[model samples]
Target chain A: MPTREINGQSIEFDNEGFMTDRTAWNRDIAAVLAKEEGIETLTDRHFDVIDFMRKEVEEKGTAPSIRRLNKLNVVPTKELYQLFPGGPAKKAAKIAGLKKPEGCI
Target chain B: MKKLLILGAGTAGTIMVNKLAPVLDQSEWQITIVDHHETHYYQPGFLFIPFGIYTKKDVIKPKRDFFPTGVEVIFSGIDIIEPEKNQVKLTDGKVLSYDYLVIATGSQIKPEETEGLVGDGWRKNIFDFYTIDGACALAHFLKYWEGGRMVLNVVEMPIKCPVAPLEFEYLAEWWLTEQGLRDKVEIEFVTPLPGAFTKPKASQLFGDFLDKKNIKLTPEFSTGRVDAANNKIISWDEQDIAYDLLVTVPTNMGDDAIARSGLGDELNFIPTDKETLQSKAHENIFVIGDATDLPSSKAGSVAHFQADILYENLLSAMEGRPLRAQFDGHANCYIESGFGKGILIDFNYDTEPLPGKFPLPGIGPFSLLEETKMNHYGKMMFRWMYWNLLLKGAELPIESQMMMAGKRV
Candidate 1:
């Protein structure tokens, strides 16, 4: 783990920059992190997904996989990719202040 | 007499029965195994079926032949497990109680989980090598078919023998080249993983192999449904991949019995202690092989290694002793790379597959992570060893825990 000054406060994260302390996250931090991850504008839909992912971690102790989200009909995977380009799972997990998803790889 | 009940007569359960049969006091303990099927298929050989190397005869064997004598066998499907009562009810309405239970009910391909996977094109253009019928049907189709755009899509991850899809592409490319159809056919591997595999090093190695062989790689394509009418697979992200022949590994799930008993996750895999092999929900219940939701691969080699730890822990539990043995998720696999050469990989939870010799530290007949003809021969001879020695609990020279002494860092 490594510590970096994020949102004017030092926070712990893995080498990949996913936050280790999920509780330290807020919308201000997410907006800055999202922009760094190439998410130009944070819309209400993006907040919906980010909030849902945080809720999933609060309940399941892990971020929801793209398949899981699609199966639960939380959000269509197409919209997810459109909302967060590149890899949505990795991006959303970072913004939601959740640990990287394990179990698969 | 206290009863020891086992579910599934597959490799994991059979090996446990053999390992314990000679050790348990026959006068004090009565051993019984239950399974729904009479025939046990050598699942690894299923991959060779599509390439015309192996047939149905090579893989099919009577499950009764594998179990040792003095063990009571029940041929019936499991309905549910009443874990609290320490009893399992068979589909035939018979109740069998046990002092201890071992669940080895492995996973299977659930093609129906994906939309249109089992539709009009199934067994004709859409085939999966995970099942006997699918392999044989694909074999028949490949024998006379001309080359066309071929796409192999893996619906999700954590499927049994994670390397099978890679090996399939290797063999298919070689077979196509040998048949002078390499130029006519276009091949693509579509996977949800970021790369060729879960592990970083092996993924790089395998991804390079695919590139050198000219097979296209499509990564991060989360499959949503199959358009059988148009012979295209649609991703949940709205990506469409067209293929003349679609070979897919659909969503794999644990036995439905796990679901009926409410002892499993969403995929019906029992939540297990990764090291102790004990069910998280019960003390007396042990889980082995693909039935467990462990992060380790679902392969015969994984089950074989788990058996070593499980056997020790199981005996300890029987004697009211604390479980001491810990499984490090050791998995050894031989990858057939076609053209009579193969590669081997030995890894555990913390280690990725590295390049070096195997079994023997200084000298090994089988080289790891590098393709060699000797490795291919090792794979060919594994069948005989599997049937005669492995199933009978013979102690192989290879350690249950992976050894890194010979591997290069």
Candidate 2:
């Protein structure tokens, strides 16, 4: 297992990239993303998409497609890009601590 | 030349312009849109701005920027609509006649309707998240303020997004906890509805979440007045709930022009054939989005769905044919439950939100009526889709008509 500290919180990632502790992943990764975006705080509404992405990864064993993610989420695609400049699969998997699904790049 | 005149360039009207302008033949039909404001806002994003998740720049853009060049964008307030005359009068003393009319004039927030609400505390101790100014002002206020008893109050129902207030409370809990003030901030949710949500099954789940968050619920509260000086809200039954700060969803009404045109109900919302999207008063006139007195939610998703039906029906009406398309009152909302979890709900006029997977029944990448991290990400990513595709009237792979797919009966 590899570990990274974000915002003073220790986050442990397994060999496959899934976070050992999902709760810590959200808190630490969300903190990093929020800071990167220059957002002062991460609201529940902000987490609405982050959590949705994690669940998609957990169920499909891969990051969900952006189109599929947006269909279920009802958010606009451009905003999704802003939240995940690396695109949905990359950004969502990174935040969820899951490996980037094959063929996403 | 046939003229397609649209009233109010709000969410629905802007979408209608984007949807029809490119498709309609410019040689045969000219499209003209009327709106008073120069800017178009992502109204849903307004919910997040108050909580500091979105800034002013995130939610607004120039109206003309989104409209196609061929579509004539008229920035003027509407004075009246004479259905018999087939014309719309502007406050600028101009009259525009139309071969066909589309009323996308959206709703407004009337905080003044409630006694003492717009009194001394408005934008001070009391705030609204429905408007950009209100959201920004509330953001500033929430910054200096430490932990205290906070109340997220809804004056009435059928406000834009029903889940927004609950999202605020949930996000507030997360924010306060981060600030090390969660235990000190006694958050409460006050609504006219009996449950945490409009649907029962989802309500039960959300109600339990409220309990878990230690956020008190005051349901079925018909707010009578706001005692700003005293920091209290009084229900019609004289139940008083004191608070240090009041975040309110004001009484939502249809555009004032609807009332002025004698085309609206007491709330200024136009009565329309729920299925056909045709104005009940006139067959030639159509209404959609928050302007209508429909039982459905006043959400962007509803407007997106209605645009599909209305687009078909308009062409039918233009050809002197019967409208074959029907709206199912379908609406879906993502409820953010903080801590990187969210819930998705899909329902129509008759159905309540039920638990299940969405779009793909057995193979759901997303769950309904259950909180999951995937649902949360889905909710956040939507803003991008709104800007690029949905507002552009670009065809999404998802069907406009509500499907039984991915949902439990």
Candidate 3:
């Protein structure tokens, strides 16, 4: 288990690597992702995507793959890349505090 | 007989008056609207003002003109809303009683909310296009101005027409090119949003448009303070963005009367039921447009959609019937990408914007998530619709509810 401080909030990753607290996860990670994406704040749409990512991981045991994410909605790859520059898996894993799945790297 | 008193005759109030006036018989109900300002400026038209696409005359009109003749228009500021007594006290000490009140007082731009935004360079170099005065002043400044570093900045989010700053930058590029000063001006769009817009798909499309126009993009720049003396915007991280001319959309707050009425949140926006638009504080009052703390775009299209539902529900409330209408946060907006091209996006509470044909599926004259000349014209044509159709509360061909028909899902 490890923890990181992002955007003045503390986020903890479990040994199994899911966010210890999903609610706190959003506030903690939205700021970091927003900064990384070069946005001053997160919009409702941003929260929609972030919440979607969190739920997908909680249900599926892993962060949703890029293909799955693209097919689920119309979030353009370019904008998604800008937000999750390390790619969806890495970024989602980072935000969700989940362990990086086997194939993402 | 119940009385309905609406505060502020802005876009939201105007629509409410139009929607309720025709349906409710005057003998059975009394509707009164109070507003301090005499004029109603076509707010969306402000976007085109600085670019010379629209003139001051094109946007300005007497507020009394749009209101239906039967409805009482009181040109006075509200001092307080004594909800416990179900009475509104005006600045002139006129006490008006209401059985049910609708607060449609829209947001206001407070540039001073951000430190130094209204400092030395305010109108001289820093400008705001949110207000008629600001837009007119900016238009005058841009007329003889030789081009240099022009920065269009959004101080915070939840602004009226979130796409406006981007629209300004897009039009500025086109205007500069047309004026043969494109090379001289370095146009930059600085926003708090991650990309050109709040939505992901539209942001990608607009981000490319920014690239094509050669406009610099600065995202996530949370402004801590405006250093007017140095002509720079200092972000919380201490990132300094230098600008020769600063077009800033200051922090937009709900009408001051909301604070006086004790009917607002920290931002002076009334906390409302997301689906019903009913004021959370009082059962007899409802809120709409920019007045509500709904997680929806504060655009005219949203108001139009909400009006349909509010019209139904308000009648239900009057008749002691169950509220049947539910608003799904439907909002559609046209993003002017400049070069006579625009993009349209439609979405609701449950859906994010998807790429597909709009209004008519598969044979769209207007495309979604894609730019086209037709959408640009559609955006322009909205002005006529606003005055003739929307404000009058006339039924538009488009459905009030967000349709999944033309969209992919």
DockQ-derived CAPRI band for the predicted complex in model 1 = medium
CA lDDT for candidate 3 = 0.81
Candidate 3 residue-wise lDDT, A1-105, digit = tens: 668676677777676445666656656565664565345666665565667777776785445544346556735443565555434445555554455543300
Instruction: Give the root-mean-square deviation of each candidate in angstroms.
Output: 1.8, 20.1, 9.7
Stretches of candidate 3 exceeding 4 Å from the true structure: A1-105
The digit string of per-residue lDDT tens for model 3 on B1-409 reads 6699998888878988998998899898989999999998889999998888899999988987789878888999989998999999999889999999988888889998788898899899999999988998999999989988998888767788777787888888888888899999998898866678877776787899899989999987756689888899986556789999999988888988888877886578888988888888888999988889787888889888998888888889888898889999898888887789888888877777888998898878789878899999999999999988888888897888988888875
DockQ of 2: 0.01
User: How high is the CA lDDT of each candidate model?
Assistant: 0.91, 0.81, 0.81
Q: Pick by DockQ: which candidate is best?
A: 1
Docking class of 3: incorrect
**Model 1 vs. true fold: TM:** 0.96
lDDT of 2 by residue, B257-339 (tens): 88888898667888799899999889889998989978788888899899999999999999999999999988888888898
Q: Which of the two candidates, 1 or 3, achieves a greater DockQ against the reference?
A: 1
TM-score of each: 0.96, 0.79, 0.82
Off by over 4 Å in 1: A40-61, A64-85, A103-105
